[model samples]
Target: MPEQTTAAQTARADIPADGAGKPDAVVVRDALGVGIAVGLSGFAFGVTSAGSGLTVWQTCALSLLVFTGASQFALVGALAAGGNPLTAAAGAFFLGVRNAFYGLRLSQLLALPRVLRPFAAHWVIDETTAVSLAQPGRRAARIGFAVTGLSLYLLWNLTTLVGALGAEAIGDTDAWGLDAAGPAVFLALLAPMLKTGVDRAVAGLAVLLGLGLLPFLPAGVPVLLAALAAPAVLYVAGRRRGAGRGGTR
Candidate 1:
């Protein structure tokens, strides 16, 4: 009886608390949705990179190796503006550093096998992290992370190749507004998650800081500065709560 009970408990633990149909299937569907939507934006990166004087191979290599949209765009955009290669690389490096923080959180959530950790670390980008953390259980999180990563990686690389090859025919990617696609999808995903006052405060302040500093700072530096919004908002909120408790006494 104890054996049967343990087996039943283990099986139930794998299911999502929301009971949203087959949890694995639901996770895959959602992950694929995010993956396909954001992955297509790789076309813009390819076109922009090629237009910025990169060869087709160079553009494709960036997409394949870096796999981070914001960093790739920042590097190419800075180069297009006549920035030094070293400086451009530095800015891109700063933009991609956020992925390391994402990996720290996802390592606990996914808890993948040691053999898979290195490979999984490569896919720890904004979209995959968002999809994995949205899931209710570890099983669902793993499925979401794997599906989102695989689909986005494949589609992004494929579209990047096509875009790089057809850069001349495309003329200017900005005119087509393809550059906005990734951010649009990201905001759509993030909008639903801002369910609390602190979440909204951090997001609002981040936007303000990012946009406000855009004209004054270098490309990726504004984003790095905006990251301060989280800690600033949290500190203020913590002080406010403490003061309220003291007032109640």
Candidate 2:
């Protein structure tokens, strides 16, 4: 609930102004709603994580501090299946690779100090990065991203206790579609990013590739393949469009 005045100067003064487009309270409210809405995915993750042998404290800490759904899921899944610590760590890290790409994309928009970079980097997970980059104004984007991230982090960690205690009664996650909740959240967030036909088509290609590869690939490999394929297809499509325009010109 930062004021629209010089509050920007306190922690985020380095964020460059964009043509007098400052963030309003309404934008912050919408961003908060987005965070709360997307946080349903965390409930699924929490139940899964706790049921997989993670203590309530562990699940809460990871959700609050780490704040990445896929990574937490991978960690819990690996450990539950009796994976060694090394294997579990590896699985978690692999799932976390996408966040590094998010960092690279968002680093351009951030102008914070070296000390702040660590926290900022930690906060820039998939949802935050998507919301920030998708927003229209820089201030609004920053506010949206920060508020969404903070709100989710708090709520997610708090909800893990309920999940850990309640998962037994809840029974099989697959039957309840909780397993699909995470992907549904991703799709919900993705809707805003698909503003153009090319974006939509690329997403379609990725889904098709994911479904196609699920049978042949190992547990996590199909997602990795789809991740690589979707971007490459989009890049090639963009180049073709550019080439066509050049020929016409």
lDDT of each: 0.84, 0.71
The TM-scores, one per candidate, come to 0.81, 0.73
- For candidate 1, the lDDT comes to 0.84
Off by over 4 Å in 2: 1-23, 53-58, 74-95, 134-138, 231-249
Q: By how many angstroms RMSD does model 2 differ from the true structure?
A: 7.0
Q: After superposition, how far is residue 160 of candidate 1 from its true place, in Å?
A: 0.7
lDDT by residue (tens digit), candidate 2, 1-249: 955656536544554555145456766787788778777667787788767777778878887777787677767765665666565666577668878988876765655568878888878787788777766656677777789888877776666667766788898755675655665666676688788877788788777876897676455554456666667877888899999999998
The candidate that wins on lDDT is 1
What TM-score does structure 1 among the candidates reach?
0.81
lDDT of 1 by residue, 168-212 (tens): 998877788666665666577679989999999999999999789
User: Which parts of model 1 have CA positions greater than 4 angstroms off?
Assistant: 1-23
